[model samples]
Target chain A: MTARTPDSARDIPEATVARLPVYLRALTSFAEEGTTTCSSEELAVSAGVNSAKLRKDLSYLGSYGTRGVGYDVEYLRYQIAREIGVTHDWPVVIVGIGNLGHALANYSGFRSRGFRVVALLDADPTRKDEVVAGLDVRSFEDIESIVAEHAVSIGVIATPAIAAQAVADRMVANGITSILNFAPTVLSVPDGVGVRKVDLSIELQILAYHEQRKSIAPASEDAS
Target chain B: MTARTPDSARDIPEATVARLPVYLRALTSFAEEGTTTCSSEELAVSAGVNSAKLRKDLSYLGSYGTRGVGYDVEYLRYQIAREIGVTHDWPVVIVGIGNLGHALANYSGFRSRGFRVVALLDADPTRKDEVVAGLDVRSFEDIESIVAEHAVSIGVIATPAIAAQAVADRMVANGITSILNFAPTVLSVPDGVGVRKVDLSIELQILAYHEQRKSIAPASEDAS
Candidate 1:
């Protein structure tokens, strides 16, 4: 059998990678509440996933809980965090100081979860020199300089859909390999670059689908 | 075999339900481009899914593309929209007129996709009487009246994490059953209420996972 090494962690599935943060968040909460251990069932409920899936996902990280004891909350938390590379903070830049950008800059979750907002850049000249989250909103052209300065690998696009592609183009050109897109458009990036979108409307649309189903089905049956 | 009814559409898998909106968006773009018909390959590329997966997802909606001529874009679009219940508009109330809230209010994708933000509410008295997205920002206490007035069953929570749970509580008590949360906290909603979250930091963390993997692996071998 091949020896399990840190490199093997890279082989985890994309779906599991996405869910790792959720599991990490749940573990963080458990840690805060002074919980030392949790079974797959308990953690699954907290993560809003099934127990079997939770166990399988944890196994991807080589975290197998004992038969009677269950997972060590703090140990599993550190394991997942290390696997996700969040043990060391990742510096990031947010382009487009619009409402969404402003909210993102002020978001405390990023700071608590190993992400540092190094800079906020906006294309609009009027927005330049404005301060958000204690950082001055600079011109978008400064992205290249700021990114190089902070060695930022992640970039956020909160601009309008019309400007999303341009912003992404700039981000990729400046060596930002991972993007968190808030714009309502699909971004075409290079092979090495990663783009993950958080569309507010799409989330609402999904909820609407379930809400519609609830209206049609009997109220006694929980669609969830 | 049982006769397929409209209610049967509710049985679509959660994964398929998530992709239906994406397919619909792709079809909308095709319609905009004046393309009346598209093969599975073309639609799959537009939706950023594999052709086989696209075909399988469309099959869930009982949409079988023409043997040779491909699928009718408009027909497929309407069918998916009907299946997702976006043809009928959903009136939504947005609580918390902060930066993210402001961005959400002005998001045009919502109006086009099916959600109507009827009222923008904030707890801060200073924010009251402010105009955003052509609607006056109202007091949070007006949630009951505004929800009732619009018959809104959906609510969007863009508040700070500290206030997200409280906002969700108020939304549920005021008769909002479906919530699209942009806050960075886990919301504890009672059974029967559907809550979908769009966490920006979580998305970034997921990307960071992949980015970390790519760094460990050689560039010659694609980690994706």
Candidate 2:
């Protein structure tokens, strides 16, 4: 097997890494509309980013648009997908089969975007044997075995705030290294473990702050 | 009423605005744990931000901790909450009562964090009158009346991608100016309206990208 380049993975900025998926999605849309090639300006508009930033981001992947011909959509799309490591399926185990958990398990986007829900787990024994998203809810104790069985590295925490830390700790001990926490509380994880928190309330609170500003300063409302 | 400072709202950067809610949550935790005051270092660790950055963010609100005494916990909490505009309830309407919508409706965080869900709306007529979070699932057509009745300025869209843009357009026309979009689509809103998108898949993809990097470059794994 050929060795992958190590520097390529290390050189991309986190901000650019975050936007790669967005650019991948935009390319998918362009391809769907039967567009084979797109200028940086066109792709930027589709991705809701400016052209210069888009070009700079793509430069990290060593992709440069031709002087006049622009980028080839399919090639750039595959490059981004490979760079994001989503070209192949990544087995994910989700804990906490609550309402939000159910929504996440049922979300078709995860499966379509190269994440496979290998297991559904909950701390409560009463939830066992319950089927969600075509998978049986297993005991949280099964995390170790499931992670070992699937070689899962990414785990989702949809548990309540009180249980989130314990759940995260358990996931870490069992070799999971990445987390997408939907819990409202902050999680303290060890070094090398990546954590991304998604709080719906926080998102709304930000909007309310902006909305309040808009009403208070109508003259600056158009600034956004 | 006395005129408020016109420049305060515009001066705080967007990144600072997003972190204010997080800081508010951290302070709330400290209060619950019987801590009356906290140093910048302590609060920064709780909020998962660096102390210097946290101090700079708080400076925008005209708050500076006493050199040796640190900051009064309750005072800082209130300041952050007020700055985030969550001291008073903001009536919000959520559209699209699907699995994600059901989860959003049942989320206790929204109600506890100064947001009142005035209505749960869905386009499907079959779901009308179904109870979610103790509120009846109203028709999407009722958005206009509900916004008028509650004076709602924020709307949440948990609809499918195909239905999101239309829902956003309808919301904007009805005087709703801010949106928290959960759909997996990009929305184009007119100037003066604000939109914040929360895509579970995008967040996961970001984690996946990082996780891939960790495995590929074990030497750089601790960069996070």
Candidate 3:
């Protein structure tokens, strides 16, 4: 294996990439609590991961904690934030202003964590001009103009399953390359487009699978 | 490794466990499309996973596709459903009537996918008796009776960050062994209780991380 360099985002394992946000959150918690420095064990506990695994994941980003002295909390937090590209806010547009979309629009976490909701859109004509999260609901046909205006690279789809694919197609055509899909359907995007599906039912099913096992065999290991 | 047995949920790897629901969904789609059998490649394409990984994941549950015939769609679907313990609907309770909670209550996917929302709960007195998704919102103090009456094993925490821990504590005390937390807080549960967090901001941050890398080096591989 070649030696990894700092700021080199290439070739980082996907698993490590997923955990980076967890680590970033933990670092933020430490900094919020006035913590200046912390050992790997401390950060791992805060992030709900084991120390060795956390260190290995961090190593991919070229962050190595110092021996005995530990890591500087604020500096490490910034490094992770930069690595994850949250150092600057990214303008985002939400398509499908339904119940889930309304929740996403009013979600304060998005604005506080590196994303700004530039628009809320829906296909219903009645929804137009309605204010949500301080943004007026716009027609889905306005995607092209919205993307061009705000330079939105990320789009969120909270539409029903039947409409998710069309919304994704429109988003991709309008130059929104990254998607966070809450719809319960499989989306097909081109080679360069990125799509992430958040299915609440699937998550609950996973938990149910484990819960069933616990009842069958009480001796089974607890889910951490 | 020792030879695996069917219906033995004791040692299924967590990674494979996570993907079981995805496979189940793909199988459901195939069944919906009137497909009686499907090759691993076809199923993998539907599930957005590689053929080898899908096969390996299924193998953990003692399911091996025939050499030429592939897998029997309905049988495989039933096996997965039984393995995931979703053959019958599990009773669930939601402990917040806010925007996200409202969305969850009205989500039709949960009812169709092995879960029934037995009660909608809120700590706010004014929210009591309010109807949501055809169910009356109940007081948070009634969790114990509600859990006992419906035999609910799963609880969803949609409360704010400050109230999540207390809600989780109450759920655990009332025999809800599994929790799906949407609050942006790290919950501490005792052993034998399972907690899964769904953070919208964290998911967006992950997408932003990769999206940032894409802009930095367009030559980088696409996020799958």
Candidate 4:
């Protein structure tokens, strides 16, 4: 998975890249609370990861932390933002207009970040009457025109499981390479096209697994 | 951190454990489609994991699949379920009764996977009139009694950001050790407790990160 492109000084590991946002989020909290610096242990506690692993993950991006003291909250955040390529605006499109889709379109986080929701596309003509997050819902068949016009590379699929793959295929055919699938089913895309899934059921199920373990080992003080 | 007990290989890696439910969901889908057996490649495509990684993960649980053929869909599903402790009933408490909370309480996935929603808690006294997921909204003060009576080890925090930590603190005080946080904040739990967060904004931010990368890179298709 670390297959690097030519003339690069080795890329960060995918696992590490995933953790960068976690660390960035932790740093953001510290910044909000007026905390200027945080040791690996403090950051790790906030991020819900181990301290050593946190340091190791940060090391992959070069030493942005002071050796003995800690990492500067704002500085580390900037470095992570720069590495994540969110310094510039990113145009995005949402392809469904269901209940989940409405929640996402109404989400203000995208606008706060570098992402701009360029369009909202729906398959049903009846849904065209709907306006979500201040944007009018358009027909899903207009994806190609929306992608070409807005130069959208990222698409969000909040449609049902049956419609997810078709939406993904259409998104890919329209030249969109990255997708965030909220659908329950798995999606198959060609290599180089990134797909990150946010399955609500899966997350809850994972929690249930741990909840089961806790039931067996009911001793609260048992770190073992 | 590698702070392992004398029996180290026994404790499942948290990362691997997270992926197990995904595989279980995929397996359930296969069974629903009447697929009795499937090769690793086929399962990987449906589960959204690398085939090699999936095989490696399954190997840790012992050889359950046939070398010449593949895994028995029903057998593998049962094996994964037993390993995850989902075969047994898990009592879960929903801490907030908002729209998202209402949706979660009514979600059939939990009932199918042995997670029973024991009660729904709400701080708002006026909401007692509302009925959600066929369960009447219980008062916040009933947490201790409900947890004690139900022996709830797992808790779901769907409260808003301002009220999330407070609810989590109360849940922890009532002996709940594992939490599924749907709020946007990073929760601070005591040692020995597990917190799995599902922040909609964070997931979108991650997608935006990948989406921004594609715009910067050339459009030429490199068949890597």
CAPRI-style quality class for the chain A–B interface of candidate 3 = medium
lDDT comparison, 2 vs 4, better candidate: 2
Pairs of colliding residues, candidate 2: none
lDDT of candidate 2 over A1-224, digit per residue (tens): 26645346647898998889889999999999999999999999989999999999998887546877999999999989988999999999999999999999999999999899999999999999999999999999999899999999999999999999999999999999999999998899998899999999999999999888877774633544
lDDT of 3 at B209: 84
**TM-score, model 1 to reference:** 0.88
Evaluation by TM-score, superior candidate among 2 and 3? 2
lDDT of 2: 0.91
Task: Name the lDDT value of residue B73 in candidate 1.
Answer: 95
Assess the local accuracy of residue A70 in candidate 4 as a C-alpha lDDT between 0 and 100: 89
TM-score of chain B only, all predictions? 0.93, 0.93, 0.94, 0.90
Report per-candidate DockQ.
Answer: 0.66, 0.84, 0.73, 0.42
RMSD of each candidate relative to the true structure:
3.2, 3.6, 3.1, 4.7
Q: Judged by TM-score, which candidate is best?
A: 2
A1-224: candidate 4 lDDT, tens digit per residue: 45545332335787887777778778888999999998999999988789989988887777788988988999998888777767677788998877667766866666766678999999999999688788899999889899999988888998888899999999999999889998888889988788888877677678777666665653757566
- Which pairs in model 4 have colliding backbones? none
**Where is the poorest 10-residue window by lDDT in model 3 chain A?**
A1-10
Q: Against the hidden true structure, what lDDT does model 3 obtain?
A: 0.90
Pairs of colliding residues, candidate 3: none
Best of the candidates, lDDT: 2
State the RMSD for candidate 4: 4.7
